[model samples]
Target: MMISVLVSPAPPEGIAPTFGWGTFAAWDSDLYRNIVINGYSYDFSRNEYLVAFFPLLPLLIKAVMFLGLPFEIAGFLINNLAFLGAVLLVYNWVKELYSIKAARWATAVLVWCPYSLFGTVIYTEGLFLLFSTAALRAFQKKQHFWAAIWGALATATRLPGLAIMFTFLIVSWREKRSLIAYIASLCSGGGLFLYSLYCGMKFGEPLAFLKAQKAWQPAQDFWGQDWLKMFMQVLVGSRNWKAGKIVDPLHIIIVLLICLGAYLLWRSHLKLGQNKTQFGYCILAIILWLLAGSPLINTVTILGGVYLIWHFRAQLNLLATYGFCSFGIIFSSGRATSAERYTYAIISVSIALGLLLEQYPRWGYPVLILFGFLLASLAVRFSQQLWAG
Candidate 1:
């Protein structure tokens, strides 16, 4: 069950884990390098100060290291805990408004996700998902302040946190709870802004991380690159600093399953018509995801199975939208093969899955298995990276 298995015996060849997975593995060396040397936390020093990875994830990892747990154990504890939180929130949110079946399926899809495993490996997605869902749940209950505050915390975990702000405003206006909603929205929106300011001071320039990213990889407008290139990266593998050897094309198979999901979404949307408020939540969540870009797309695109089974069924296409967006991202990816390259591979799998859904319909699953093999090949690639750590 533990993804950190490699760290135990002999980490394979070139693998380089931060802190050697000793007491500091969870505290990514890169993350702590920024924090410990200087009191200034966040990435104003290196890149886009406004919209890079959040500080909460780094801070959390540090806390684990500080607790004296080995980095692997610390990372495992934090990430799995975050995963549990994500699962709990999704279940409760679905159960609160819709049927138990919806909640159960949502949680299952999320928990079983191959991609979600990344979160369980000291990644940020699970923490972000947990906060995002909690924010949404709060909004649904008309708990404006709580929703905004939680949503803000979620945003601190990932850039898509803004979706909470957008949805809260929309729902508040719809329900005529304008004042409370406005207040909550401000609080939620302020969370990231405040963090950004702190990061700016630490880095010498505000939004330093933002500036650095532009310099690192300048993306043209309409950045999503061609679909084929995305496939090659996955089929072969991508070489990125962030994710190391990430050629996992397994998600391509998941994307293939969206066909039935889209049909279900259309039918369900038509069937539910105007009465489905939960669908609105999905819409808002999707919108937030689109804006967050990289991490969000990575999280959303590999969800072929889950989307196929969404309870509101009609909202299924909402799940499919990530594929289209991923097309745009592949375009943005440049000649340099970085973590973004593997990301393109993901984007490639996404939109391709959308096409397969429309065309083969029944043939989707087996094809996914094939693509998954391609992704699996990358496993060998990273053994070096992990061991070297």
Candidate 2:
């Protein structure tokens, strides 16, 4: 549907954009394709943006290219394959926590989300989902070794992979698990740890990846004032006569929905379920929010994850923790460039909606239909190069 919508408006006369091996290589896919072909270069004068991307997906693309396929073809195939694996893992994980119906619904939500088209491109969302879901499920099933393996791969895939470690450690400590289990879970960061060492040797800074992100000049206020102020500015932009592009109705709707979602999740339980662990995460999220100095969109995604955690704390503690940790890690950096894609990667909103649909089939179907409509609209906007995010 999206491709068809965008395909009609052919390039204007003489304006020829290189459509790399089908349109799947749109936008950020070009970066991954270049990474696959040229490999990483430390020369800041040329390709420093490469450092913002993790190495695992490009490495996987290179391995796939060994089969003599075109780079774009290999990249698309890799993403689609990983997406299939991710959907299946999500289904199984939700099934373990809930029911088959809920699992099916959750898988639908995961696979067809508005921002999920990235999973079909040469992006890390698909591969990251495969690794993150596998690690989360393995940990839930008491398969610590497998969890560590997947978590390590996930960490190598995206920075947010560190969320798995936080989830693992917190859950382990809460359950009074073995020290060995906690240590094993900590191994999830092994890939990132090794990469940092390699970076230090090559680029003379173990934190070179962190330094590379400076190209984006992500907004930051360690005191939290800038973060909250930006959020409020966006929230009540209508009141500001000269707010300009910052006053987006979509953002306001998103903020209201996030607040409403958190309230709903809180009321999902009869008694307030606030505890030290939840409070600690709340503080962590606030601190991260303040330090991140990210835009309003990214903050909303984090709040969405917090709402998911608050809502499902009783039904499934593991899912809530996973959601919170994932949101925290993503928001920690403070860039809102691809906040929607990042939120979909964590996927707690989809999971929650899926279960809600299963629980209330009557209204749930209607809501799902409405959501589908919204998703289609967003897809169309994205296909047309509009600001769907």
Candidate 3:
């Protein structure tokens, strides 16, 4: 993060950096800060609605600010610390279930993935990952009390945390676990239930959070035009997709060539070795991403995640169920915005990838190298107040 800040070009005229932290507090960061300082408010006239944001991070920042820290410092401290805790939890949990090598690779993937930029910034990704991972790990260990506590905190942090709660309930039913398991599963949603109560009292609408989401993302029918545009953009490049014509023939050509190369690589039985082939694919993927950008990423993360979960379902068990549940919710949202970041936060994807990488350590190295490059680029983009993830 420091390197990203240091390498960032100066802000353009009429633009200001966020306290020399390069604009880590841009976009949703500002909204979170507003929620912290001014508290929640709703004003359609001004197009302001704080209820769209969950209260956990802002509430934590407010608590930290009571000690005289500014919003930026408090937010940075909280998010980074929470991210570190999440890394530790993921590492230990993976090590317990798999191998130490897999655990190390998993933590590395979590840190180096480009979307991880959100974890270090003033977003719920870090806090949500920490709480959700804790809850999932505790449940795996049969620590019902801690699972419920962490699960409640997770749900309060982000809506996807509900997937963790549902995973518990489904796994308990399938396994015929004790009544305490069912109780804990239900209690896991306590945070969301409390938030709903607050919304009912404050706005006279218990589902105001869901309503406010429409402000950011207008409702659309299932598999609507927006979804089609996103998927097409991934294949043909954004310009060509939006223009409804081949604005850049080279883009589609490159995409097709990359796809062909991937298929050939999969079919080859050459003696080139797995390391070289994996590295080659990594380079091709980087080129593909460069052509298609975030739409491609969003497509790959969601679709690829589903494939990973299904392929590893038996080994992953509860984690696989959580991945499916998370995807189900994301699909219902009917928008592609932040899909990569949201999918990455699910933890199951990371663990699944880590387990896959564990068997092919050579392949893991190039993947991690690619991830590091993208991670640095994303950090610089975020620091420059540009859209990332």
Candidate 4:
């Protein structure tokens, strides 16, 4: 439905070739008339730095562009296919663990979510989420090899994906089957190693993403003399940092309602005491993911794990709350350019994890949602203040 909607609205014009990088290789290339064959890093026009983005997403976009489909159409088609995969996995997941209503609501929320359109930006979110969830669903059934294969694909799509095999760690430990999970995780985790090695050989460091972030100045100035002062300000009373302001009070209200819905989902989960461990893994994964990487990388691993909180009987804990705050701090303290938008992930993931802590109870769900929205409410206000120019 999404693809067709955008397809008629936008169709491809002609053919193109993009064999290499440094020529606006990422999503920007999706908008180009042709994908030029250029080198990966060097010889880039000053304005072509958009190629700094990862490779897989653009290549997918290029293939779609090759189908004579417009860029927007291609993006929609890929995201639509991803949506289908996400839906199938989520539906099967909920059906297996909960009720038919849960399945319906879960799929409905994701499919109808406007914010999720961000995933359709010739990016990896849709594909990553779909594959990761499907892998988890496979694991739930004890299909080890299939789970490993999916994890490998998932890792290929999302950089943090290599960590997802940790699920197998728990499974293996509990079931006394280490060798298989080890083999699977190793095979899937190898790319992360290879990528690092290749990057080290090329750039004299194993952490290419980190190098890229530093090279591109995506974070604070590594050499700024005011680092101490800036860090203090960001942690306490921030002045230089930026956030957003929602112009629509009604949208604010709607976001509040969504928060309420998410709260209800959490409350529903906490009712099962024995299921707390499972809940722990899902929410703990989110917290850890948030703490371990950059904003984009954190979002994928967090979302992949959070997609499986179907039991609706989670146990709320204070430690989880603290972890969320710490994660938010790091995100908000980043560089000022579009830095505020990071709050969306911080708030959403935290709330999603918090919901896993307990069933916020039906009576309190709406009020808690209001509070969550209110807390996140400042995010919009901050964004406007930052981008006021």
Candidate 5:
């Protein structure tokens, strides 16, 4: 956090002031703080972007301020504290899956991830991690009801969270083969359902959040014909470096690499005695990529998800259901612009990478060092209001 502040120069023109808040609160942090202080407005003439941000963290910030702490302090503390809790839950959860050594590696990788800086800031990553990890832990313990409750909170934290419900359904079916599991799984989306109701009351449109998303940027659906046309153009080289919004050479490469990684990782897992389901997960991921237009963010996150499914192949149904569904929810919308941040919600990426490193200690040290270097570099850029993600 201190390095982030020191490396960042003074705020540029038109940028929101930190107002004595820490530099960590820059970028999307300001949007959250604004919502905390001013509350939501339906007036598009004002802050229409607020509708896109979920209410959990900002509301927590406001609640904490009642204890005489300022929003900055409250926001920062909440994020860090929630992250600490998440770390603990993740440690125990991974340990339950394998050994304590693997658990430690998983926790370390999560903490040292290039994107972990956002978890330490006033962003929703920390809180989302807290809820999502709790949900996973509860589900692993076979506490289906509690899992649904925690999963519902996770959904409230982020839209991708609804994907977790699929995992719950799988678990329930495998454990009891009952319809109650399906019914209970629906509870996972209760938060989004409630939010839609709130939007209906406040904006006269239950899907106002979807509409407000346009105010931020132009986003396309992954299933749209345009994405397929653009993908083909990028592949055929008919589209140059800067052709259509959809066909950036860099992002196209990212998509290709993601596909290659998933395939290679699937084969490696099978060679290691992992099940066919691992390969099935990879195939499912590819199908989603084909349909979703495979944005850079989605591509990277899906690659991570494929690796995770392979790593947790023993629990293939459990992790695969959650991983694929989460990717599906994000790609279902078609724009992968914020995927760097959105990918954080996947959580399995960090764990899977950590597990991979643990199995290959010779490669682990260098990878971690590289991760730290990129993390610090990105932190500096993000603090300076430069786009890193």
Candidate 6:
């Protein structure tokens, strides 16, 4: 946070740069601040709608504002504190289920990943992660009441929290848990239900939040070609994909070389040691993702999450189920914007990556270094009011 504030460059001519803590409160932060100070508003003509944002973060900020703190301070404190709590919870939870080493690596990944910038900024990522992680941990411990309570708060914080509720309900049914487990699962969605009720009473539209999303990214067809475009952007460069024709022969050559390298690596795997082979694969994947830009990063975050969860499904159990449910919601949204941030919020991805890194400790160092560079870059971009995700 300090780095973001201190290192932000001056805005371009004729543009005012946000300074100090305010720098963290750009884009979506303004909407949250407005909601906190003046409550929700919907202005169709101006495309201004607070209904599009979930209420929990603003409400929490408002609660803190009663102490006479400004919205920026309140929001900054709330999000940072919640993120701290989340990291601690992740550490302890992973340590308990896995090992001290695994816990450390996972915590490092969660804290240093580029998307961690959202946790620092005025966003629901921190609060949502804290609540959802608490709910998942509680459910794993068979503490149904705590699970439902935390899960409810989670749902209120973000839509992905529905995945937590679904995970509990489905897992309870599959495991034939007691009625209390089932009841808790149903009760987990209380936050969303309450929000819906408020929307119905205020706007005469219970699904106003979902509808308001069109204000940001107009709804696309359910099985649209957007996903294909995103995939193509990953294989080719975004510019070439957007050109609607092969604008760069270099992109094609790079893609073919990557494929060839992968095939060669697989064929020669028996000759290489396990650690070397795994490290080589990791390096290759990172290179490919970096070359592809944000679209590929977003695509890989979601699809790679699926691959991770599925590969470790037996071990992850309910966590895997939650990951799938979250991904399903992202997929169903039919838009790719912010997919990377959303995927980062799913605790399963961190846990899975942590577990994998624990085995190949050698890979964790370079990965963490890379993550640190990306994290700092994102923080700088966000502070400059540029799109970091």
Highest lDDT among the candidates is held by which one? 6
For residues 1-389, write the lDDT of model 4, one tens digit per residue: 22223222222431232222211123333423233224244222343333234444555766877878765556656755885777676666665665565455455444433234434444455776676666655665667688777766665554545445655555556567768666775665554565566656865656654445445654455433233433333232222222323333443343345456556556766575535534544454344323332332323433332342322214212212322432344343344332322222222232333334334333233334433443333322222221110
Compute each candidate's TM-score over C-alphas: 0.58, 0.77, 0.93, 0.52, 0.77, 0.93
Q: Lowest summed-lDDT stretch of 10 residues in model 6?
A: 10-19
- Looking at model 2, residue 259 earns an lDDT score of 61
C-alpha RMSD for every candidate: 11.6, 8.4, 2.2, 12.3, 7.4, 2.2
Task: Report lDDT (CA) for all predictions.
Answer: 0.49, 0.70, 0.85, 0.45, 0.71, 0.86
**Could you give candidate 5's per-residue lDDT for residues 202-317 as a string of tens digits?**
88888777677766766455444444544454353334434645554664565576667777676677465554545455454545445343242334555566666676766444
Candidate 4 deviant stretches above 4 angstroms? 1-39, 42-52, 112-114, 197-206, 221-389
User: Which clashing pairs does model 5 show?
Assistant: 222-334
Please report how far candidate 5 places residue 331 from its true position, in Å: 1.3
Better of 1 and 4 by TM-score: 1
Whole-model lDDT, model 2: 0.70
Evaluate residue 163 in candidate 1 and report its C-alpha lDDT on the 0 to 100 scale: 49
Which residue window of length 10 is worst by lDDT in model 1?
Answer: 341-350
User: Candidates 3 and 5: which is better by TM-score?
Assistant: 3
| Model 2 regions lying over 4 Å from their true place | 1-7, 10-20, 43-47, 218-302, 377-389
List candidate 5 segments past 4 Å from native: 7-20, 43-47, 177-180, 219-240, 243-302
Candidate 6: clashing pairs of residues: none
Count clashing residue pairs per candidate.
Answer: 37, 0, 0, 26, 1, 0
- Candidate 3, clashing residue pairs? none
Per-residue error for 286 in candidate 1, Å, reads 27
Compose the digit string of candidate 1's lDDT tens values, residues 236-273.
Answer: 33332225444454433333333345456667876677
**How far is 201's C-alpha from truth in model 4 (Å)?**
6.3
User: Model 1, stretches more than 4 Å misplaced?
Assistant: 1-51, 70-72, 218-222, 226-228, 231-389
- Give the TM-score comparing model 4 with the true structure, all chains together: 0.52
